[model samples]
Target chain A: MHRLALSAVLVLAALSAAADPLPSWKDGPAKQAITGFVTDVTKAGGKDFVPPAQRIAVFDNDGTLWIEQPMYTQLAFVLDRLKVLAPAHPEWTEQQPFKAALEGDLATLGAAGSEGLLQLVIATHSGMTSAEFETIALDWIGAARHPRFQQPYTQLIYQPMLELLEYLRGNGFKTFIVSGGGADFMRPWSETVYGIPPEQVIGSQIAQRFEVRDGVPVIVREPEVAFIDDQAGKPVGIQRHIGRRPILAFGNSDGDIQMLQWTTGAPGPSLGLILHHTDAEREYAYDRESHFGRLDKALALAPENGWVLVSMKDAWSHLFPPTQGSQPDE
Target chain B: MHRLALSAVLVLAALSAAADPLPSWKDGPAKQAITGFVTDVTKAGGKDFVPPAQRIAVFDNDGTLWIEQPMYTQLAFVLDRLKVLAPAHPEWTEQQPFKAALEGDLATLGAAGSEGLLQLVIATHSGMTSAEFETIALDWIGAARHPRFQQPYTQLIYQPMLELLEYLRGNGFKTFIVSGGGADFMRPWSETVYGIPPEQVIGSQIAQRFEVRDGVPVIVREPEVAFIDDQAGKPVGIQRHIGRRPILAFGNSDGDIQMLQWTTGAPGPSLGLILHHTDAEREYAYDRESHFGRLDKALALAPENGWVLVSMKDAWSHLFPPTQGSQPDE
Candidate 1:
């Protein structure tokens, strides 16, 4: 009976050890920093103890939570939408950006620049009812697959980040996604994927108007860009939507520098984390000179700002979540 | 002993009956409508049942939740600020709106129209960091008393409406204040006064820019109108902030017509209520012909739209909460 009790105690110890909040994160300085910050802030009667209502945590989407590799997921969706909508507007066949997009000519499309991209985005994203736009986005997101991963785009979300979001939420912190991505584009799937409700997701927005047609009230998406939630816009967007400065912020690019500064610079205990894409084997690794999600200024200033640099190659034991019907990565 | 047991049973029955969710609401059709709608939507497995996540309730602030007679609380605040700021700007004594404002000339200020009001608002509300502005607003709101009521403006809030907010929250509905007032102005006190957080309050906003001044990050308010949250702007603001149509909406003026239409027009169980100020003896009673909070079009369309008209005099047993040192009104 004594021997049996000893074995049961051993098994219980093993189970308890396996219950680490962030199992996908390797034992490193990055992980230790995050755990330490959370502990300090949450300890009752401690110097850093923040009330639950003030425990606001902000996260950047795209490269921070998911994959933003050769191209952004939203950009991919826009390109696909352009092709699908080209036949409806025959003039698209002759238009420069449209023709370049149809031919999959990256060079010409790049040459068309931001104005051209804006035209493409507006054409695909607006001039429809908000509900209709949401349906179209949902349908595309459901069916679309990553070019290299051969998995659904949503499946490419980083496992460690997902675990971190859940962990923060478990500790009474209100997690908000303050992204440069379009708010409407992200809201449809954010709740199901990130466990964040639409109201908590702050992002770029296009002008929308309320109208009644056939006695049915509908919000119609217009072509004008109302706000951009990027760079300096990030802090402005956070202030506008949240009205309170977040105590913790996470991001992966220079576009997030302002947000991180705004968060960590606040008085009291705070933390800023930058995800360093240094894993070339598991995920494409490019920064500074990269076309997408370039991490430059933030990286140089990370140490001075007391921002934690989470090296993907060293800190993350696993990249993507386990795929169904497939063996788990060991 | 049997008589004593009967008395105890009767006392328990009285206690249970007194535990009505909306105690300040009188026994009337309006009260019944609100309770009935909440019951139907929250019933599990019922035909009219809605998921808790989609149970959104929106309320208008001015007149609907508090007194807006004599003048809007915000307008009064602006006038008071102008008088205090007169010494800082000697040019204001010469400027048209400023001169009229400093001299307490309501007719000239009114004749100056929205342009003059905009100038007054910008001068008083902008050119300061968000934190500074918040402190200023809080100080004013804490000290400002209603001209007629002689009570703090926050104390003039409708007691029955507060009970309704609590009741809806108890039934798993998330309550949001969609007001025409400035978001920053309301955010400083909304949580303490109305039990609504800053993030859940949507309203008019001015342009703001994020700046790092002397190694400290700040958001500076600019003298530009970014978006207006009144009239047609109501539904637009609701969609921008909440990203979901509210199932229940309450308002007191024509400015809320679109919001009411958007909520009840949805293909589900919904309720729209208009608070009719008919208590001239207790509170100011003006609607259709009133200069402020004119409830003309919405009042006429309320019957056909299936909106319940709640009479302040008949449907509310109490208007304001009990004061600390005053006897409770019967």
Candidate 2:
């Protein structure tokens, strides 16, 4: 091609890149809805324009942002931690939840209910300095691989959702992770992976106390649950941390129903998006009947609530970002 | 004067205005220490230079930033609320702590100790939706006047500290309020008064439940103590909310000593400052023996800890920001 023609083509490509922020998102209702809402809320002097300060967008972490497939990454962390600390706590070998955890008894662990889960979480998560906990979490995240994807758990994060976060942030929306997972677990890596700083992430908390150990101040995690940021807890967590009703909220399961309701139920123009995991070929498709991230009630209420149900299969042109030595999901 | 001379003079004036970020802060050791620390940390390629993301500064709200004398503003709100709520609860008139609060009997209330204070806080601060509580707090903050200052509580904020807050932000520092005041109470007006957003304000909290009442979601304030962000609680709150230790901390009481220790004890260049209320003429003075914001242990440890003790009288050229109806303190 001639120099002028080549330059014109490059200009056109740059223009297209500038026009489409969510390059991984296909041209569909889901993409249209997101862009439309963003434009409506961002256009200066527009009727639906929301000021930058009030343009808070909340996202649920597990199935919404990354793969929560086989099990939550935090649960995996807890189980792994249980094994690591098993020799230290000989009592855990006999304890109901600990025994179930050690034996990889999912049925028994599930049967133990939330109480049993809490026991396991506290046993593994607590009795260490916050710094120590952070190092452990970081190490796990760096080394842990997704069972199905055979990639680092961080690498398994949805490419389209990452683009959505960037797109929203580009439009002056403050993106936050309001997750049910432990805040401590996510804080170590959220900044690097999601471009979300620790303060912007709100999650379930364990009690912590400040101590001066050997003339140095350290925050020691206590073996008690302080707050849970799931379902009804999501809105409460948002209120407690952000102190402002988010204009936009996205999540996957029944655990996010209340957050969706709270966001869409606001007086102003708001957007609630439910990520319907419909692409089983690329990612797990189980929703309504799934044990984890079950989407029964939220899926049922989506149409009536005016929430945009995003079909991953149709909406996302890509699932995970490209990885070295790994082929794209065919 | 010639046009060229006038232009030169104008340039010099503009440059002078640009050079002084903290005009309200007099030229003294306190001011020098603050500016020196900020310069050292913000200067690129310097050994003490901290990245913008790690440049976190925390400020204590009541005594550090504003007038906490003549009793805390929250305590006054509680006392006033007791009167308003007394008609509904006739038994409160006969109750020991309630009666003391209603009668303004400080001695009796003091005798009742922390338990009584908690009772008062729970009674006044809870039993309503978060929105309702916010409106109530905002209304009180709007109308309540500092008895000695004879100005609205928000206006009683230190002009020098406000300048410092702006200066820090201008130097790429994220300023946060870590106070013993209720988060809900401060969230309503913190942004307006201190330019610190609600999310950045970490404080004491009461239990709150998320409820969908009449198809509308609301966070209802529960009459139970959840978390206290005072003394040792300050560091815990920082870790829980911010997930990072601040490099700079400013406070005025023994209640802030732990926060100072936590901030300065970090393995990096850090600055901890204690504001001493030594301005008896411009503001209330009594420190070691004061009922509220008593600076005793922190005062003794400031020198040993390498914490800058900022003398309000000597360091601050001005106290409160200019008010429409009030004259400046002579």
Candidate number with greatest TM-score: 2
Could you report the DockQ of all the candidates, in the order they appear? 0.77, 0.78
lDDT of model 1, residue A181: 90
Clashing residue pairs for model 2: none
lDDT of 2 by residue, A54-172 (tens): 99999999999999989988899889999999988899878898999999999999999999999989988999999999999999999888777788899988878888999899999
**Candidate 2 local lDDT, residue A270:** 98
lDDT of 2 by residue, B132-175 (tens): 99899999988988887678889888878988999999999999
| Positional deviation of residue A140's Cα in model 1 after best superposition, in angstroms | 0.5
Give the per-residue lDDT digits (tens) of candidate 1, residues B189-307.
Answer: 98888899899989899999999999999999999999889988999999898898899999999999999999999999999999999888778788899877889999999999999
Error of 1 at B270 (Å): 0.9
On residues A1-330, what C-alpha lDDT tens digit does candidate 1 reach at each position?
254554454356337534788877889999999889889989999999998888999999989999998898999999999988887999988888988988899899989987888888889999999899999999999999988777888888987898899888889999999999999998998998888899899998999999999999999999999999999999999999989999999999999999999999999999999999998888877779887898999999999999999999899977876542221333
RMSD of 2: 4.7
Root-mean-square deviation (CA) per prediction: 5.4, 4.7
| lDDT (C-alpha, whole model) for all candidates | 0.89, 0.90
